[model samples]
Target: MGTMGMQGPQPLPGISHVIAVGSGKGGVGKTTVAVNLAVALGKLGYRVGLIDADIYGPNVPTMLGVTRQPNITDNSMMEPILSHGVKFISVGLISPGDKPMVMRGPMLHQIIRQFLQQVLWGELDFLIVDLPPGTGDVVISLVQTVPLTGAVVVSTGSSVALQDARKALEMFHQVKVEVIGLVENMSQMVLPDGTVLDVFGAGGTERTAAQFGLEFLGSVDLNPSVREGGDRGMPAALAGPESNLGKPFFEIAHRVVSRAIEISRSESDVLEIS
Candidate 1:
């Protein structure tokens, strides 16, 4: 069956689609996927903006190599930092040192709204919000603020990770957000001796997606280059088209775009039918 045709919050001005890349739990490489997905979309010739809405842990700025603070226009609008062919903003960039964000619900709501409405994103084809792990205050604020085009939940092959990924999916469902798909990060590792290892116990995410009748976008194996790139503020997917760690991200990006198109078409059909 097609996705239910329910209206959501209106899109932000000049932003056509809003995709949230999220995870049910941390340490599953959710931020990595968000960073590379934005870069991959930019590589596909789209005007992309990535917002690190993960207030609890804003790693998007670090992954994108954006060290300097954003500039403000004379009118007091914050200018998004441009890096790696993508425009982005992150709470990490503005916060001093590694001090944690201890904001309450209202503060998180205001910050997210400011990032979405105050930042001069200009015209963009896609705005990817890297949500903090779990269904927290920020997630609720986002759903209430603007209509999400859809959400892409990230997980690994571990049962524990898949368990939380399911909760994340359920949260989106409860909020009436169309779930675009699931991404299995760190699904496995291929050793130098041509051996494959299910480091996290393989296929858990895919199986869970099947059980819920959700689309399993694809999986990305564990790779050292990916970690190195994140540390250096360069996503592995942007390493080059032919790179081993990079290619998977491009493939995942393609699936994400394809799913979004499909959902759009389905909604159009429903509108016409009504």
Candidate 2:
């Protein structure tokens, strides 16, 4: 697939699509959405890879239940660890054991570059990048180092969260990266008696997406199973799309695929015209 030509960095060889998942602020379950989306895509029989780009917060390894560091190949390239059928790499794996990552912009850029170029990702239909919350140096480094196929902004349905989500969308715009859509995480809660509650406010994310002219991919309810799965390093998406908890993720995965294809086509058309 042809990558969008806005950024100078060319697409990595052997990777078809590079999708970044980000949020305006923290505590919005951005990494959770990224991990589950990757797993769901894998469940759909696609070769998927996940990158824990959240440098300081490197939670992808914990969420996917992978604790070991990546193996170094003969060529010195790092081999991503496999878990839940998805190949992944994270700083958490490299610098494990709760030691904080204290570094400046140059160090951040170097690590991000290493993760992108020094990894033996092999062939992948989709490479989901779990970006750190908020618009920061890490995001700038990523865009400068990769031609993203697109990005998915994650947000809750609260006004404060949506405000930050707007900044995330605008950040993508400034970098000329196409936003595939917005995924509303923790949209609501369902009580045992079948009553639905708008704990975070209803439809705010969808409304924000519409305001920004972006696709509202779908929403994942604030369910205990989702939390349990994350804590156990077993994403709820492992339950397959047939389960209530897994269905929304699969739906978002499908939408992401469609959006990616559309972006590829549009980019191809632009290239041909040029």
Candidate 3:
């Protein structure tokens, strides 16, 4: 398997960036950031794949409005569902629509392993992984087993989420996983006259990122369209990139691409010296 003994993570092939979009807590728009970011990357002409790794609360199947199950090939590889010009595979798509997953750790590991080894993911420029909230065993297993390029931490600009976000970052550090940076979701509200409101008590995420010497990718405005789209099983970023809320996701995508290039270059320079 490609994941086995993944050789030093040296600028891996078949995919340029494998980013885990995660948060310290749920309800902080973690998956929303992930799906929209994948769409935004696709819009920028990079072939992308979205993995709904949130095994427990899988939602990509619904967020992208994908209801059909993927078919497995004779070789045992399953085709990923396609939506909004991006490829996807999710636990949400694995189970029947009305059922919830009750798998244990071994089963979770097996399913995750299958997601990697049994899915014929095409050569993608980016594979954005939407992880479940918090620093749990699943997250640790993924970091230990997968060749992640880096991770993006998502959180609201609130104290409670920030506390958890800090813990999440610490957990990533404990596992020697490099954190790409922080993204403040639902940071503010934009009004009709182009004014911004610090409704969630602004700047908490920014301050945390600054203290950690991490880049603050940027903040996403809380838009009614985003909520409405989620309710209607549509990702808001696809509907209108020009919209106030949708625009941030695109911008964040660009920033992440730039950060990735910088990291790759630095790593390359280090290799050259040795």
Ranking by lDDT: 2, 1, 3
Name the lDDT value of residue 7 in candidate 3.
43
Q: Runs in model 2 with CA error above 4 Å? A: 1-7
**Per-structure clash totals for the candidates:** 0, 0, 0
Give me the runs in candidate 3 sitting further than 4 Å from their true place. 1-13, 192-195
Q: Name the candidate that leads on lDDT.
A: 2
Using TM-score, give the best candidate's number: 2
Q: Which lDDT values do the candidates have, in the order given? A: 0.88, 0.92, 0.83
In candidate 1, how many clashes are counted? 0
Worst 10 residues of 2 by lDDT: 1-10
lDDT at position 66, candidate 3: 82
Candidate 1 C-alpha lDDT tens digits along 61-143: 78988778999999989999999989999988778478998888998899998899999999998899999999878788898
The C-alpha RMSD in Å for every predicted model, in order, reads 4.2, 3.0, 2.7
* Residue 238's lDDT in candidate 3: 82
Each prediction's TM-score versus the true structure: 0.94, 0.96, 0.91
lDDT of 3 by residue, 5-32 (tens): 6643233357777788889989899988
